[model samples]
Every structure is written in C-alpha cells, then in structure tokens.
Target: MSMRLQGRKAVVTGAASGIGAAVAARLAADGAQVFTADIQGEVDFVADLTGTDANTRLVAKANARMGGLDIVVPCAGISTFHPLEGHDDAYFQRVLDVNLIAVFRLVREAAAHLKAHGAGRIVTIGSTTSTYGDEGLCAYSASKHAVLGLTKSIAAELGPFGVTATCVQPGAIDTPMTAPAFDQMPEYRTFWEGKAPLRRLGKPEDIADVVAFLCSEDARFVSGHGLWVDGGAMVRH
Candidate 1:
C-alpha cells in the first residue's frame, strides 16, 4: 500500500501457498517486483529446492526475471511427526535437506547479487520450535534451530556490505504444512489456541506482515535477529 519497496527485486521460495504465498503477495503489493518459486501451483520458477542445482537455477531465473535481486525469503520447509525413538537417519536427512541445507544453498547462490545491491534483505522462515522443543518434531526443531544460526552467520558476513539477514519464527500457523498435524492431533488446534495470548490461531498473513517489515527500509538497522510472530505463544512456552 505504501510502495515502500518500489524498484526492489525479490525472490520468494515456497510461494505457491501459505506463508510463502502471503509474503510474496505482500512484497509485490508493497511495490517490489517479486519472482516466486515452488514445486507446485503457478509460479515464476518451479523446482524442488532440495535438488542439487535447484537453488542455482532458481536464483538465476529470478535475477533474469527481475534484472537483479534485493530480497530473498527462503520459506520452503517440511515436517514429520515421529518420536525421538523412531527418528531415523533418512527422515532426519530429508527434513534437513529441504529445511536447512536448501536455505544455505539459496543464500549462497544469491549472496553476491544481494551484496551488490546494497541494503539487501534476507528473511528466513523459522518456527517456534526453533527456540524450543516440540513433542514429535525432533528433526524439524533441529533444522529450525540451525536456521537461526545460519541467519546470524549470514548477518555477520553480509552486514558490512549493507545486506541484512533475519529470521521470522511462527507458531502453529494455519497452512497446508500443518494440516497433517491438525488431522493427526485434532486437539493440537485447541491446545495451540489456548496457549496464545491472542486466544486464536495465526494466519499466514500474521507472519507475512512481520516479514514485510524486516525487508523494508524501516528495519535497516535490524539484522541477525529472530522476530517471533507467534501471537504470544512463545510467552506461554
């Protein structure tokens, strides 16, 4: 509405639905030309982020489409429910590949372009589990925890170049990714709702709004921080 991001170019992953979709739409609405990537639905680029060359190709395509890059939002992720005793190496690896490793690769591929732009922004989507543990989300939690570390590391390396890196941690968002959890544990919905001070579930736009701020000029001095968009869920935790 403010056109705060006018002339800015952004690439948002997992943009077909949920928080990613909301974020992409918000950035575009804010006057940034957005190039989106996803394995499904209509998007500018379609590729699995876990693929070996997917990150490279995605960044190349975004740069080509937008002529340059100023913002990067790595919002792709996956989660599975399994106790620690049942946690297998394959499951752990798969979660990390999509949630953590892919993020690193995406940022690595886009780092130079972002640096060149100056005031470049990298906003990663982490989770409430990033700061704490979840009942059946060992691998997901670990990957999210590592996301904070990755963002902070990137901030350290990119801050001098006028590029900022930050993470937004959401709690119990209503999205396709959490649909399975809601189905398997129906009570989870009510439980999360009660845990939040807002006494309601979080919408994709709830997280997207914070992301918009972190990517805007208003947050120029913010970096290496994980902003919680959890509707006070973290406070209860």
Candidate 2:
C-alpha cells in the first residue's frame, strides 16, 4: 500500500460504523495513525461527541494516541427525516446538534493543535442531499449545507497557517446510513441507478479513495472545494 499518509496523525469521529469507519480503515491503510472515537468501543476511544466533556475527551485521546494531531475528520452525524408538518423544534435541534453543531465544536477544539503542525487537513463528510433537496430530508440537507460553509470558511481562514479544509459530499453509498432507505423504500434504487451515470450504488471505497487523495500531498494546492463522489447523480438529478 502507498504510504501517502505516513507520519500523519489524525482523528475521525463517528468511526464506529458507516463512512467514518471506512475512512478510519482507509487512513490507517495509507499509514496515518488514526484515532477513531464513537459512542462505543467499535474502534478506538469510546466517547460521544455531542457533549462538551466528551468532545474534549475525544480530542485528548487522539492526541495521546498519536502524540500529536495533523488531521481531523468529523464524520459523526444523524439524519432526522420528517415532513414539515410532522417535524418539531426539538427534533430539528437534535439533528443540528449531531450533524452540524457538533462538527463545529470538534473543529474549534482541534484547530490549535492542527495549526501548530502546519499542512494540516480537515475533511468533513457532507451529503448530496445538500446539493439536491428532497421532501423529507429538509433538516439533513440544511445541516450538510452548513458543512460546506464550514469547509470553505475554514480553508480561507487557515490557509495562511498551512492548513486546509474540504468537504466530501457523497451520494447514496451502500452503508448502514442508507440501509433503512434501501429496505423501506426499495424504489430509491431504481431512481439512483437510472439517473446516475455509473449505474450503481457507490461503495465506501469510492469515497474513501477520494479522502485519501485529499489528505495527501497531491491535494496540497486544493482547498475550499466540495468534491462530489456521486457518480454524476447530482448533475443528472
């Protein structure tokens, strides 16, 4: 395997499963020392990222694990899909808390350490829903759109310090995150396959490969870009 991430130290949240878990494995394969934290011991540290104390503990564990930090990937998120009529304020808050706000909190805590290292990378997982809206995914779409904003702002703010941030907005990758839709609304497969140029649901490796590039020297000049791994679904839809 290529050692593109050798000597790099990174932390990935929501790493117990789904994209976060795939990213953790990919980063490790690329030679980065990855500290993965979730609500349970599915990977590395077992800490929930929704609270202040837990966020602090996650970062501390990452620092201790790698001896320093050079990369931060905030992949923890939840989707609260509801129609406007049924959606409540409390539900919206919880969605924002997990998907958008928690990511910001993690970055705020990790910023100083990343800045100190220089050439640090931040890759946040966004969604194609942000680019193309659906009836039931209002909250999720809005939250992910916020991630794009965070990515661009961070890239602009931290460029002078040799740090960069980018968002990887993916389409329907066949992960646990999408399993419910696949099982409950099997019709989604037809729409996705018919419109996407690739004619297949994305695999975790499809996105993981791009993340690897973003964290490597090859993407040194690239920042503030929301690279899509949607197999042209965004364009066709």
Candidate 3:
C-alpha cells in the first residue's frame, strides 16, 4: 500500500515459511524488491545456510538477482529442546550454526554492498530468550544473545555509513519454528498467552510490520537496538 521502500533491493532468508515468509511479503508490499532463500521449498534460491559456502553463495545470488542490496534480513533459525545435562556438543553447535553463524556470514558478505549504497538496513531476528535463559533452550538463548550483540556492533560500525542495524525480539510467536515446542508442551501456549497484556500469541505479520517500518525511511534515525514484538509479554513477565 505504502511505496515507502520503492526501488530498494533486499535479501531475506528462511523465506519459505513462517516469520521469514511474512517479512518477505511485507517488504514486497512496501515496494522493495525482495530476493528470498530457504533450506527447502519454492523460493528464489534454496540454500542450506548452515553449510560453509551456502551463506556466501546466497548473498552473492541475492545481490545479483536484486541488482543492489539495500536491506538484509536473516530470519532462518532452528531450535530443539534438550536440558543442560547430556546436551551433546554437536547439537549445540548445530543451533549456533543455523541461528548465529548464518547471520554473521550473510551480514559480512552484504556489508560492502550496503555501505556502497549509503542507506542500508539490516534487521536481524532475536528472541525473548535473548536476555535470559530458558530451561531447555540454552543453545537458542545463547545464539540469540550473541545475535543481539552482533547487531549492536554492526550499528556502531555502520551508522556513519548511513546504514542501520536492529534486532526484533519476538515473544512466543505461533510459527512453524515454534510449533513443535508449543505442541509438545501445550502449557507453554497457555502461559505465554496469559503472560502478555494483549493475551495472545504473536503472528509472524506482527513482527513483519515493525520490520517494514525499520527498513523504511520512517525509522531512519532508529538503529542499534532490540525491539520486543512480544505483545507486551516482556513487560508483564
């Protein structure tokens, strides 16, 4: 509806479904040309970002497909439950690979193009657990915290280049990434629903709306921050 992002070129990962899909759609609706990648499904490019060359290749492909990169949103993430005891190193590393390293490599690859453009936006995804630890989400929480830190550093370094970096921390979003946990522990759904003053689980589009504003000139002066799109759960919790 609003052509706020007209002529902007962007890259979005994990765009086949869930939050990534919502973000890509929102950016497109705002008039940005979006190139999307996912591990599976029908997207512009299929990339397993956890692999060594995939992240770099995805960035190059997106840049080529879109013409120039002005926005970067890395939304691909995975989480599996395991309490501290006997949580294998391999499992923890996998979470880090998907959630943290993927973003890092992609952002690193996109940095030059964004800086060249002189008005770039980088919106990374974080989680409510970014600031604290959850029982079985140790790896997820750690990776998210590190993502927040990485976004902060990016903002500080890129602000002078007219680039903005921010993180969106969503709380208890009802997405495919979260469905397994909520399904296995139905109580989580009830608790999160009751915790928020809004009394609802988040929708992917809710976070997407904020991301659109951040990518647009409306939020030109906002950067280096983490926004909680949690339906007010953080305040209530």
Candidate 4:
C-alpha cells in the first residue's frame, strides 16, 4: 500500500461534508492521522471557526489528538448568489468572516506546530469562481480571490521556515452546498455540464485526489500555486 503521508498529522476544517470531508477521508486512507473539524455535529470536532477561542481550541485539540500537526487544510466557507446591487454590508461581512478571516485564524494557530515539523504543508480550498466570475456571485468570487491571495502570502511568509502553502481551486463539485441551486434550476446543472469539457459535474473525489497529491512528499518543491481541479472548465473544448 502507498503510505504517502505516513506518520503525518493533518487538520481539515469544514470536514463534515463536501470537499472537506472527502479530503479528510483521503488523507486518512493515505495514512495521515486526520483531525476533521466542522461547525456541524457529525465531524471529528464541532466548533464554529469564526469565533477566536473556538478556532484556537480546535487546533489545540487536533495537535493533541495526532501528537503533532504537519498539514492544515482550511475548507470552511459560505456563498450567497445575489447580484452586487443586492449585496448588503452584513452579508458581505458574514461571507468574509467565514471564508477569509476564519482561514487566517486557523493558519495562525496551526502554523507553529507545522513550523516545528519543518517541511509543513498548508493547503487552502479556493475556487474557479475567483478566476471566472458568475454574474450573481460577486461576493463569492471575491472571497475566493482573497483566499488565493492569503495562500500566497502565507507561502511567502512560511517558506523560510520550511512550510509550503498552496491553494486548490475547484469547480462545480456535486455537494450538499450546491444542492439548492441544482434543485432550483435544472438549466443550471446543464450549464455546468456544457461548460465543462469533461461533460460532468465534479465529484468531491476529483478535488480530493489533487489535494492528496499536494500534501504528498512529491509536492515538496511546489508552493504558492493555485492548482485548479475543474474538469477542463477553465479551457475551451
């Protein structure tokens, strides 16, 4: 069996479902000691990441559970598909709080342990929306863009300490988070399919496989890269 991440410890935020859950499980399958945190009850740890103390405590627990931390993947975020004109201050702050600020705090807490290990990995969940914006999702696109920026900033800051950071940008993964839109507009699903040269919506596994590669030893030389796992959506057929 391939033990790419053997003996390493990983903490994944938003692990209760979707891409986060898939990443956590894949990492575990590859022999990393996985600590999956989410706001909901079903994950390994339940904590709202936006709260200062909660974010800290979750990281502390993860470090304790796995003996040490080597990898951190922040996957927590939200989306509201309203046009820019309809977006209000409160909505904007909420999106930023969960998608951007929480990731900052998670890294802040997890970095020390990762640095101690040297050759640490920090992977953030970004999106193709940051590259190609949809009309009704200005806020989401902005948040994802910031996430890519954050990933780069941290990569630059932590590289000297042997910690490398990268962002994975996914497109149209079939998850509960997208269930509402899929149900509301069948045409929307068709749009995603037609737009993708692969002629299919992304599965969580599709994104998870790339993430697993990023965290592996083979990726030690890569940093500050935004790897897109979008089923050829970013390209023309």
Candidate 5:
C-alpha cells in the first residue's frame, strides 16, 4: 500500500465482518488510524445504529480515540426478504432506520469534526438497488435510493468546508449479508455472476479500493458523486 491516508483518522461502522471489515482493514493498511464500530463484534466502539444517540456518541468516541476525525464510512445495514404484500411497518422501518437513517445521523454528527479537518471524506455504502429495484427488497431498495440523496445533500452543504461526501453503489458482493439469498436460491449466485460484464460476483475488497481512493487527497475534486463499483451490472440493468 502507498499509505495514501497516512496520519488520517477514520471510523468504519459494521466493522465486525463483511464489507465493513474489509474497508477498515484497507484504510488501516493505507496508514489511517481506524476506529471500528459494530453492534456485534470485538470493535473499538459497539452500539446499535438504531439507537437515537448512537451516532453522536460513536463519533465522539472515535474523535477521542483518534485525536480527530477525517473519514467516516457508515456501512451498517439490514435487509428482509419479504415481498411488498408481506412487508409490515416494523420491518420496513427497521431497514430504513439502519440503512438510511443511521447514515444521515452519522454524517450529521460527524460533520463538524470532518469540516474542521479541512479535507475530510465521507464515503457511504449504497447498493445497485439504490438505482434499480429488486424483488423482495422493497424496504432495502427504498433505503438505498434515499442514501444517494443524503450523500448529495451533504456534499452540497459541506463542500465549502473542504469536506467531500460521496456514495458507492455496489453490486452482488460475496458478503455475509447476501449469503442467505444465495443459499436459498443457488441460481441467484449464477444470475448475479452473469449480470455483470466481469462475469463474477464482487468481493468486499473491490468496494474498499474505491473507498480508499475517494478518501485520498487525489479525490479532492470528486464530491457529490455516486460511484458505481458494480462491475458494469448497471449497464445490464
């Protein structure tokens, strides 16, 4: 690694496993001091994103641990495999709370610290579903779509402070979150593989690489953009 993020401080949510873990490790490898947060994991900060005060408290703790904040990646999310007819208010609300609302709260809470850094980066994890709807993922898709709006709004408001906010839309990455869908419908895996031009499912590191770039000084001019790291899956859509 080139240590592009040397001397930077970062906080990665859902850092116990999957894409979150990959991002945390990659940022650290790039020489950033990373503070990890997750509900269930041996992380630097443990808290449920659904809680009202979790985002605020988490940022405070990360700032204290790292002496400052430069990067924030809100990667915690949940999904339910229920069709619209079967979707209940509670289920729908839960998905939005974690995937969408939590991102909003985290960014809002960390904005001041990030703005103070003068080159702070906020990279959110969206999904291919952010642009295209998927069956049995009504709530999940809705939440992701909202994430784009949130990122752009933040970018607009924070740009003057030298803070950049962007979102990454990932395709079918081989992560624990999507394992159940793959297991239930083996063909789902094959379908995702062929959907992308690369003809293979994505890996967590794939998304992490893009994140690292966005956080680097080289990406200072790139803000309010939703970079699709989906192996051309959106083209097939």
Candidate 6:
C-alpha cells in the first residue's frame, strides 16, 4: 500500500520463519525489493551465519543481485535457556556466535556498500533482554545487550555518511521459536500477559512494522536508539 520504499533494495537475514519472515514480507509490502537469507529455507541465500564467510558473502550477493542495497535488517538470532551454573561453553558460545557475532559481521560486510549509497538504513533485532537481565537467559541477554551497544556505535560512526542504524528490542512475541514455550508453560504466557497493560503478547507484525518504519524515510532522523516494541510491558515492569 505504502510505496515509500518502491525503489529501495533491502537484504534481510533469518527469513526462514518467525520475526525474520515477517520482516522480509513487510519490507516487500512497503515496496522494497527484498533479498532474504537463512540457514534453511527458500530464500535468496541459504547461509549458515555462524560461519564467517557466509556473513560476508550474504551481503555481497545481495548487493550484486539487487544492483544496490539501501536497507539491511539482520534478524537472525538464537536463544537458549541455561542457568549460569552449568551454562556450558558450547551453548553460550553458540548463542553469542549466532546473535552477536553474525550481526557484527553482517554490518561490517555491508558497511562499504551502505556508505557508498550515502543513505543506508540498518535495522537490527534486539530483545527486551537487551536491557533487562533475566534468569535462565544469560547468554541471550548478554548478546542482546551487546547488540544495543553495537548499533549505537554504528550510528555514531556512520551518521556523517548518511547511514542510520538502530535496534528493535522486542518483547515476547508468539513466533515459532517461542510458541512451544508458551504452550508448554501456560503460566509463562499468563505472566507476560499480566505484565503488559495491553494484556496481550506481541505478534511478529508488531516488530515488523517498527522495523519497516526504521528503514523508511519516515525514520530518517531516528538513529542510534533501541526501540522497545513490547506493548507497554516494560512500563508495567
């Protein structure tokens, strides 16, 4: 409906499902030509972002295919529940590698093209845990916290070059990754519901809309911020 991004080209990672898939669809609906990447899916690139080269190549391939890149939304992330006592190196490292390292690498790889374009937008996916530290989510919280810092640094460094960077810190959304937990532990869902004044959990579309806004000219002046799309849950907290 809104053709604000009609001529814009975007690369969205983690497009296989959940928030990532929603973001890809929203960007396309906003009229941007979207190139999607994921570890497994019918996407533009099936990349295991945990690998260094894959992160780099995903950007290059998107830029080449789209002729130019104006927006980049790195939405790939993994979360694991582990107590600090026995979090295990493998689990912690895997979470960091997927959530933080891959995001950093993608931004690094895409910086040149974005800078060259002189008006690039980078919208990263952070989580409410980006600021709040919750038990059993040490690695996820840590990585998301780092993401907020990373996005701020990116904005400061790239603002002069006409590039804007921001992070979206979403609350509990009913996505594939979280649905099972909500279903298995109804109390968990009820707790979140009670925490929000809106009395409802978020939908992937809630996050996708904010991301699309950040990538458009409507948000041209908005940079270096962590937007919490949590349906006022943080306020109640």
Q: lDDT of all predictions, in order shown?
A: 0.93, 0.86, 0.93, 0.89, 0.93, 0.92
The TM-scores of all predictions, comma-separated, are 0.98, 0.96, 0.98, 0.97, 0.98, 0.98
Kindly list the per-residue Cα lDDT of model 6 for residues 53-130, writing each as its tens digit.
Answer: 997788888888989988989999987567899889899999999999999999999898899989999999999999
Q: Candidate 6: list runs displaced more than 4 Å.
A: none
Clashes by residue pair, model 2:
none
Q: Where does the lowest 10-residue lDDT sum fall in candidate 2? A: 40-49
Off by over 4 Å in 1: none
- lDDT tens digits, residue span 1-237, model 3: 799999999899999999999999999999999999999998999969988888788878888787889999999999888999999999999999999999999999999999999999999999988876689889999999999999999999999999999999999899998899899999989999999999999999999999999999999999998999999888865
Better of 1 and 4 by TM-score: 1
Clashing pairs in model 6?
none
State candidate 1's TM-score.
0.98
TM-score of model 3 (CA atoms): 0.98
Model 4 C-alpha lDDT per residue in residues 1-237, reported as the tens digit of each score: 368999999999988888899999899899899998999958888988889787799888987788899999998888857878868988988888899999999999988998999989999999997667778887788889999999999999999999999999998888988879898988999998889999999999898888888999999999997988888988862
Off by over 4 Å in 5: none
Q: Write down the worst ten-residue block by lDDT for model 5.
A: 77-86
- Model 5 steric clash pairs: none
Q: What lDDT tens digits, residue by residue, belong to model 1 across residues 43-106?
A: 9998889999999999998898779999999999998798999789999999999999999999
Query: Any residue pairs clashing in model 4, and if so which?
Result: none
Q: Which pairs clash in the backbone of model 3?
A: none
